[model samples]
Target chain A: MTLVDTLQTSFKAVLSYRLRSLLIILAMALGVAAVVMLTALGDGARNYVINQFSSIGTNLLVVLPGRAETSGSFLGAVLGQTPRDLTLKDAQLIGRLPQVRRYAPLNVGEAELSAANRLRAVTVLGSNANLIPIRHMKLAQGSFMAQGAGSNAQIVLGAKIAKEFFPRTQAVGQRIRLGDSRFLVSGVLMSQGETMGFNTDEIVIIPIDYAQTMFNTTSLFRILIEAKSHSEIEPAKQAVLAAMKQSHDGEEDITVITQDAILSTFDRILQALTMAVAGIAAISLIVAGILVMNVMLVAVSQRTAEIGLLKAIGATSADIRRLFFAEAVLLSMAGAILGFLLGQCGSLMLRLAFPQLPAWPPAWATITGIMVALTTGVLASILPASKAAKLDAVNALGKK
Target chain B: MIRLTAITRTFHMGEQAVYALNDINLQIASGEYVSIMGPSGSGKSTLLNILGLLDKPDSGCYELDEKRVTDLSETEQAQIRREKIGFVFQSFHLVPRLTAAENIELPLTLSGIPSEQRQIRVNEALQAFELKQRAQHRPAELSGGQRQRVAIARATIMQPSVILADEPTGNLDHQIGAEVMTLLENLHHRGTTLIVVTHDRELGARAHRQIGMRDGKILTDHTDDAG
Candidate 1:
């Protein structure tokens, strides 16, 4: 038969059982829609994480005073104990390394900042003047500490810290106590918001010297390093690692982490998680495939007499098989179209619900969804098509 | 013209072999109206099926128009069935989902006839069968006579050389059965071979020649004019 006539005949037969056809299409649509939406969510989350890492200066490096060991039995590194004496002198030595544009020795401690009767627990950060530009901090009022202000007991309060401690009053030029040592508020920092749940504007920044003396410890918690350019970040990291290796006598007591490496590791972890979720979602597609097979089997049984009559009227086995295959393909194509539209709408709704979330559905994902639907439909129709093609005309006719 | 020599057909019910047609020898010329009459299990339908190329004979040399069709492949037989033979079943075998027009156009469509020409043939068949008013109705919605008319229209739409009617009126009333037989005979008069398989003696006797069978063998082959 002509392809048009065959398709017309198949479509008429399918429509004769309208509710059953619709149910099969709906099942397929749900399967495809689930895959699309879940994969889109995974893409969005991965993009959001990458964007978060990029928000911090891409040329920045974080140095932690610890050793990571790789051994034979484990096949991976175990974290060694950190050296408790990472002082400002070490920070200066690292800063003097070639390719190190600037470095900030940071000491982190928890304390209460009190103004009149208002007191709140806040993270206190001790760093040099380089911390302002190196960490991309900005000022809301007054100014950051100068080079010698570390010995003068002056501090810069973050925007939220200042707002909480000195609500109606100007935080700059006021005194705030950090564990019995009162420091002048030299500047109020601009709001840098939060990353991964750590609020940047809720901390107080002081100079490195005074913080070491006040906290009664010489250990530096972290050191922030900025490179001269994007291309120099790796060179700077290697230089700092070499310096630390020399200083620690080849003990590998410090880690130099580049922002790119951190972002890539985060991306890899998120990608694995997304793939795991998508794999689970694929189970529904398998179920849909089975449903297609079952429905096609039922359809073959229901149309047995029609198949017999067609054969008796000179329809080739190939023709009968092609007609049934076309029916499956048409059903799947309809489902795919519906699923694509529904998935797009669902993703859009998610974007609207969570405006801060990023959306990045890759082109291959949509193509995969379409191909998967089509494959499922074709695979599901094979048994039924073969059965229909192989039916005995006399027996099938006698069945009715 | 058609010829059959020593045509033997067997069916296997488990380990036992049941012969449906046994050493059947017959010759029918073009435009001949022949009726196959037999009681149940007497091989009338089997003979008609073999004649129409719908079934294969086990040890036979069957020729149609001087071409041996008994040994042809299944596909070749199907091609011959499509090109030379049309079938009308007792149940009508009309596709219930298709309209009368669509049903009549089915054979032409399968033969790759273009839609425009198929439409013309379908219209002609509908007019010839006096089913034009019911052309759009599905088989389920049509009366038995109307459905049989549609079936006959479909079977003859391609103008095949022979028409095989297997109890064509078995499910119809007497008057409707007569009308259907008249339609088949009229097609026979127009130079097409007509073969009818039936158990009704009155209907069988109406044909130009009747072949009666018993115990898988032909008992009598008589010309109606002689009778």
Candidate 2:
């Protein structure tokens, strides 16, 4: 028979047998949709993490007090034979290096602050004025404490803290009681949500020296260093390490980490996770393929008399094969189109539900889902089509 | 012209060979109306199947219109069947999904006839069979007589030289059976060879030539030249 004639006959057969055709189509559609939706979720998570990391300042180097080494004895660390503390003097030495553009010494503590009888416990941050630019923070009002403004009773309140402490009046010029002392609010930080892990809208910032005296400590928590350029990140890390080693009795006890390293580590992990989820979704496609085979087999048996009639009317074996094969391909093509539309709708809903995540299916996954579905459908049709083609006309006609 | 020489067909039933056709020799000319009648297990159906090219004889020399069809390959046989033979079955084997007009156009479509030509031929067949009103009806919606008429129209749409009818009216009532038989006889009058296999004596007697089959052999052959 002609190709058009074959396809028309197959289409009619599929349409007449509505329930069987719908079941197969549903199975195939679910397979394709799962692949698309799962990959979108995985890829969205990866993008969200990368977006969060890129939001922080680039070309950043961090110096932690202790060396992160597997060879270090746990017993030594437990017995307090730890590495020397990273001090503000070390931060100063690192800040002067040519590779270093700016540095912020961070010391974190928790305390209660009161203003006009309103008291609430809050996290306190100790850092220099450079912390604003190094961490990419913005100020809403007034100015931050300068570098030489050491031991002054001056503080910066976060947007949320400022609102809670001095709701009616301007917070930048007001005085607030912190710990056992009182300090003037030098600035109000902008409402920048969260960065890394800290909520910029909730914390309070003060000069590092004043925070040290108030908390009764001489050591620094961690030091954040900004490189002059992208190419200077490695040099900046090395310079900070060397400066800390010289200040701590010629020992390289501090661990230095670059932002690029941590960002790539997270990227690799999330990409792998996406691939793994895609693989899992592919298994459902295989199950759908098997379902197609089963339904086609049943169809062959169900249409035995029709096949016999066709053969008796001069349809060759190849014509019979083509008819059934066309039916399978048509079903799969329809299912794939339906599934693509369903996946797009699903992704749209996801985007609406979680606006921060970019949950669009990758082009490769879309193409692969369709291609694999077609291939599986055609492969699954082989046995049933051949069985119909090889049917004995005499016997099939004999059947009721 | 048609010729058959020493045709034999065997069926294996639990390692026992039961001959369905045994050294059967028969000949039929084009434009002849003939009927083969027999009781159950009389091999009349097997004879019709061989004549229709739906079954192959184990040892035979059969020729149709001077062509040695017995030795032809399956594809070549199919080509001959498409161009020269038509079949009407007892059940009126219409595809339930297709309309009456589409069923009549099946052979034309199979042979790659264009749509415009197919439409013309199908319309003519529907009109000729008096099924113009039921042209759009599926088989399930058509009555037994109308279904048989549709099947006859489908069989003759290709203008085949030979029409094989196996119990064509077995599923119809007595009045409808007479009507269907008249339909087949009308095609025979138009010079298409009509071969009917049935166990009904009255139906077999209606043909100009009658052959009775039993035990895989022909028991009697009678021809009335008066018609």
Candidate 3:
């Protein structure tokens, strides 16, 4: 028969058993949609993590005061114990390195800020003027603190703190009492939204030493460092470690983490996650394949008389097999196309619902969905098509 | 023309071997009208199936138009079936999903005939069977007589050399059955060889040559009476 004739017959057969064929198509479509949507989510998460990290700084490195060499005993804490406090001298020493462009010593604590009779508890970030460049932050008004030793009483207000504390008045020139010390506000930061789970817009920034005096602590929480260029990141890390060791009495008690290292670690984890999600989704597809096989078997048995009639009208066994196979391929193709459309729409909806996630389905995911669906269909139909082909014309015709 | 010699077919009923066709030998000339009549246990269907190449005889040398077809491959047999033979079943095995015209065009479709030619032939067959208005009706929508007419139209659409009909009018009323019989006879008069298998003696008697079968053997042959 012509290709058109075979297609027509197969289409007619599928339409005749509408419910059965519809069930198979629905199963296949859902299987494919699951594969696509799950992969999109996984890939989106991976991309979002990398994007969050990249947004922090260029060629950046973080110095935390701790030696994680005894990491074996640390159960849930990523921040290891600090053998000795990281002093401002250590940060100053790191800043002297040729590979290091800038560094900001940090001291974080919580305190109540009272201004205009409105007092609210706020997280206090203690850093110098270099903190703006190192943390990639901007200001909506007023200048950032002048770069100097850690002795200034000038402070900056994050956008949320500015709007909440001094709503009717200019917050930049106001003096706010922070834990008994009064400080002049030098800047009001722009509204930078959430990043890496922290909202920088809701904090107050002050000089490192004043913060240390208020909190009565000497250890720096973290030191943010930027390498002169992308190629200098490793050298800057080694330099910073050496400087910290020198300042801390020749003891290696600090962990220096490069942005590349963190990025690669997250990249590897999310790659595996994407593959694992796809594999899990593929299990559903296999189940759908088995459903296809079961339905085809039932169809073959149900259409015994039709098979006999075709054979009686001069259809060879090969013809019968081709007809059945054609029907299966058609169903799978239609289902796969529908599933791809549905999956894309689902991915779009997910992105719309959570705008932070990059939920666009990748090309490989789309191709895999279609190819796997078609392959499953062909594999599932083989046994039933062969059975139909082997049926004896005389006996098949005798079936009521 | 068809010829069969020493055709034997056996079936295992539990542990007993029953000979469905025992050493049956027969010959039919071109354009001849013949009937095979028997009781239920007789070998009427067995002989008809073997003659139609729907069954394989345990031992036989069957020839059609001087071609040795008994040992032909399954595909070759199907090709012969497609090109040179037609079948009409008692239950009127018209594919219910297809319209009457499509059902009549089934053999031509299987043979890969172009749609234009197939459409012309189907239209002609529908007209010849006086089923023009019912051409688009499915088998379930047509009466017994109309369905049988469609089946005959399908059988003759390929213009096959021989038509094998098994109790073609068995399910119809007397009036409808007579109409169906007249349609088959009309094809016979057009020089297409017709072989009817029936339990109805009246249907069997209408054929020019009659063969009576019993106990898997031909008990009598009435070739001398030419209707």
Candidate 4:
């Protein structure tokens, strides 16, 4: 038969047997939509993490004490191997590099800040004046600490800390006792919501020397360095390592982590995760393909008499095969078009419900969803189509 | 023209070989109307199937229109069937999903006839069969007489030289059966070769010649005047 005639015949069959056709189409569509939506979630999580890291400031480096390759510099003290202390002097030498913009030396401790009998336990962070620019922090009221370093009593309170410490009074120009020392309020930091697992608004800030005497420690918690430009992060890391080795009697005791390295590591892990979930969702598509095979086989058997009649009316076996293939393509094409719409709608609902997620269907996932469904549909059709083509006319007609 | 030489077809009915057509030699000229009548399992249908190229012989040869068609490939046989032979079944064999007009155009469509030409020919067939008013009706909606007429139209739409009817009236009432027979005979009168297989003596007697079968062999042949 002419290709157009064959196509028309197959379409008419599909329309006439609406229920069976709809079952196959629905199976395929759900499979495709699942792939799209699941991948959107996985990739969305990756993007969310990347954006969080990006907000911590670009061209950044995190320097930790001791050989982090041998110690989880995080849990080294608990593990009985003490990491060498990193001091504010090392932070100064690292800042001298032409590629380095500034470095924030951090030391964390707990303190009770009392303003008129209002005592709240708060985490106190100690850093230099450059901490404000290096960490990309802003002040809502007053200025940050004056640059000359000593055991100065100037302190900045986080927005939440200031409000909780002095409920009815102006927080700037207020005095709060830190251990045995009284400090004057220097600035009230703008409220920064939780970022990279740290809540800036919930903490108190003091100069590095004052925190050292209060906590009785010469070691720093971490040194956050911002490179002069994006391309200088690697050079800045090298300069810090060189300076640490030269100053510490040639001991290579620190681990430097660049923002690019950390970001790429996260990117790789999340990319793999997205692919794994997509693969899992694709299993449903295969099940749908098998369903197509099963339904098509049943259809061929049910239409044996029709096949026989076509043969009797001079239809070649090729014609019969083509007609069946046309039916399969028609079914899958309809399913693909419908699935695209369903997947898009599903993704839209997801984004609406989770505004922070940045959920979107990736282009590759969408293309693969439809293409894989089409490929599976064609593969599934081969067996039933061949069976129909090979049917003997007289036997198919149920005649002896 | 059709020729068969010592054509033999066999079937195994649980270990015993039964011949459906045994050593049968027959020749039919183009445009001749013939009827093959036999009791059940007498191999009348098998013989008709062999003549129509729908079945193959176990040990014999078949030549149609002076071509050695017995050993032709399945595709070749289908082409010959499309261009030269037509079939009308007792059950009508109309595709239930298709309307009367589509059913009538089936063979032409299979032969790759263009849509414009297919449309014209189908319209003519609808009018000729007095089914124009019912052209859009599916097989379920058509009367027995109308379904049979639609099948006849489909069978002849390719303009085949031979039309094979296997009890074309067997499923109809007497009046409707007579009406179908008249249609087949009218086509026969127009010079298309007609072969009808039926056990009804009345139907068999209406053909120009009759062949009787029993025990897988032709027992009698005679010239019969058209009723």
Cα lDDT tens digits, model 3, A97-195, are 999898898999999999878899999999888888788888888766764534658889999999998888888888889889999888899999989
TM-score of chain B of 4: 0.97
- lDDT per residue (tens digit) for residues B1-227 in model 4: 99999999999999999999989988888899899999999999999888888889998989999999999999999998888999999998888888999889888888898999999999998989899999999999988999999999999888889999999999999999999999999899999999999999999988888999987788888875552
DockQ of each: 0.55, 0.73, 0.69, 0.73
Tell me the deviation in Å of residue A229 in model 4: 4.3
Each candidate's B-chain TM-score, in sequence, is 0.97, 0.98, 0.98, 0.97
lDDT (C-alpha) at residue B184 in model 2: 94
Clash pairs, candidate 2, are none
Predictions in order: lDDT: 0.84, 0.89, 0.89, 0.89
**Model 1: residues with Cα > 4 Å off, grouped in runs:** A70-84, A112-118, A129-154, A165-187, A228-233, A248-251, A359-362
TM-score of each: 0.90, 0.91, 0.92, 0.92
Model 4 local distance difference test score: 0.89
Binned by DockQ into CAPRI classes (incorrect, acceptable, medium, high), candidate 4 is: medium
DockQ score for model 2: 0.73
Measured over all alpha carbons after superposition, the RMSD of each candidate to the real structure, in angstroms, is 3.4, 2.8, 3.0, 2.9
lDDT of 4 by residue, A143-169 (tens): 767655345688899989888887788
